[model samples]
Target: MQAAGPGSNTARPRNAAACVQVRLDDLIAQRIAARSLVLAASRKVSAAQAGVKASRFRGRGVDYVESRGYQPGDDIRSMDWRVTARSGRPHTKVFQEERERSVLLVIDHAASMRFGTRVCFKSVQAARAAALIAWSAIRGGDRVGALGFGSGVTGEVRPAGGPRGVLHCLRALADWDTLARVERESGPAPLSQALERARRLARPGSLVVLLTDGFSSDAAAEAPLARLAGHGDVRLLLMTDALELAAPPRGRYAVALGGVRRWLEFDAAAADTQWTDAFRHRRELLLQQARRLGVAHIAVDTRDDLSRCLAPLGLALATRRSYV
Candidate 1:
């Protein structure tokens, strides 16, 4: 998608402050759009079945039950070596398919996320994105939870099923966004700390979705992210604004920062190259990290439609025909 720059209709609104800030009603309204999302792929089973059905799409089993004599069709990877040696017989591990999968949203409200040269701030887009995912997860019978971290404060909502769970997440998201806006000068909390907290809160086999601009993520975050991925599915949603993806036309421009207006000069030959390269490097670093961990990475631009941006997630979770 083309980056929205100066004078573009898709760029900052006339009343930028109001448009940039997230609103609870806007997040709550995502539930209607979320109805079209399919969070996980599964074959239709008997109506009487309890809990989420085992899906081949998930690839990994959950909740170990016990060991049993190995069957001809048993997956060899699940061989219970310890039990087999003691029993003097081949045995395989058995796992009970997960009842309700928990989906944890780790949202970043870093100071960088507060700036946008598009329809809204990166933080606003992140909140909307998290809300859609939260609503979709609840509709799919999964528990929804969230962790909002930025600056001096971090808010968490433990996983809960149904609408209640999603509401808690939405509230936390909105509250954190406000906090980030008010405490803009305090700088951001380390992304590593938030990831570490997420690792602790997430249950095994849960799905963890991290929404951030990646401004604060660095080498320090790799270990915690890797550990979290080892135990559950991890997806990264990298939020970006038009300005971050591409530089504006070279010229002197008036800008506002913290309610103070100032003039800045931009030159395509030097400043533009450096600006583009910096953003590219940051984006590449995040992409490389995601690849190393074997996780999904989605780039979300401020000007893009939320529904379209999330289509890949829906597809990854289920078959194409599963879209509602």
Candidate 2:
């Protein structure tokens, strides 16, 4: 085969997945490296007028940009008295338009996340989404942190600013996926622990984003979600499969028969109607609760484009009146 030139898409090994994990991961990661996951949460809050500078040191008072010589039609109020007195130049100072905010991501990577019938599994999708959001939050000049949650908070990346800090958050989620595990005997970590961390780490105005399949066998996710929602601007981005959203396939999908792949007796409509309705109801219920609490709620299937899905959020965030 002829070697492709620079910028050509490399053909990956085809036999493994419907889409390769790394390809999907990279694709999802690139879509929002600095703004991916936070787009949804950012939408629920306010945004700066333009691309914000990266800063971790949130000023108690808004910082002013350099005072330049007053230009035509410059606002008289912007005139800096100190500069006018010192240099005798007509100088106008511009205040930073965006206030600094922190973002916390709670990610789940249990055995269940590994089950995906589409281009990527929920765990892989969650990782990519978390990576993108962390990047986006940093770009918006917000402190970013993450916790890998399973039965509990298995890993934590202390909140900080910049790409290094974002990477710290990503590695905490990705690297920890392998290193962390919960026992079946122990069950999933009490959701309370994860919520407590979110509460303690996040101040009133910070943004908290949770990426999960909403598939915990635990009694209810509502309590933790409610508490976390109370702490800051919290958004729940439910990552789930099409099957969960769609009614079970009518007849059958291929299933393993004995030791070999063969047609097996299956009931497409066997799922209890009550169960299906309950699942749908819960997804919406979560959204309603988030809304009631002023938290942004968004649902994205694993198969969707990471960028386009976030554009609505960007527009939503663009309307924020800066705190400063």
Candidate 3:
């Protein structure tokens, strides 16, 4: 049996083996290069806040705009007690609508993402995608934060503005990516739990980006995604590998994981059509659920360029649906 397999059209160059490891230096370089790229839909953030586009809804901001007599349906929680007493009538504080939105990245650095036959690992691609989005968010004057999780480790960063926020999120991404491979304690699916955590971190008028390999695309993931999308613009960027979509020709291939090497017996008897179909079905279901719950979904093959794949869809996610 031949040890080498035919490369897919989407696969990277012949020297792709050199790019296997996830490097912080490479991630930093990608961020620096992203400075020249512009995200068009992110520019409509002010319009989204104004309700002109069905994107993010306006929420109470830090800057006070005005105070006025409370209307019948006005939220009681927003009532200004001191102003009400001073005016001898019920009053409410109105805040300026926040146009600068928050960008939240929910990245999964699971062990399954560590295996890649071509180009780079899914984790590396995810990191590259995150860097691109982080820099874009910062350039658009939005706050950036992240929830990085894998195996038994999780890191959370609160939303903040400017280069500082972007840098912090990138550091967390690098740290988690580096540690994911060493973590052997696996429990209840990490993606589902990560999504639940993401739902809690999301604030109204925020953009939440989920980066995963569709490992937990089951019932456990749907509810939390719906909840997250209810309050924020949720975009699911799924990472895939060509090997999962199609089986290699008949062969007994050697594969290694967690320092253990094993041979996968494949022959005419092992028609992988069913296995490939199941993988395709799972991906389809995730995409369908995203549509049903109003979450934007984009699929990226590990062999593809992260920046090019996400630029167009990122714009659509910014304006296509309402985050209310």
- lDDT of each residue in 83-124, candidate 1, tens digit only: 999999999987755457788999987777777776777877
Winner by TM-score: 1
Worst 10 residues of 1 by lDDT: 41-50
**lDDT tens digits, residues 1-324, model 2?**
011112211122244442323233453345334433344332222324323554433442355667788888777877898988999878977665445677888877655565555555666566666666667776667788887767444677778877778766766665666454333324555445666667777766677778766654233556666776555567677887655565545555465633577653336455546546766764565565566667665676666665555555566556543333
By summed lDDT, the worst window of 10 consecutive residues in model 3 runs over 1-10
| TM-score: model 1 vs. ground truth | 0.75
Candidate 3 per-residue C-alpha lDDT over 112-153 given as tens digits, one digit per residue, 9 for 90 to 100: 667665566777777778888888878877788999876755
Measured against the true structure, the TM-scores of the candidates, in listed sequence, are: 0.75, 0.64, 0.74
Ranking by TM-score: 1, 3, 2
Residue pairs with colliding backbones in model 1 are: none
For each candidate, the alpha-carbon lDDT, in order, equals 0.77, 0.59, 0.71
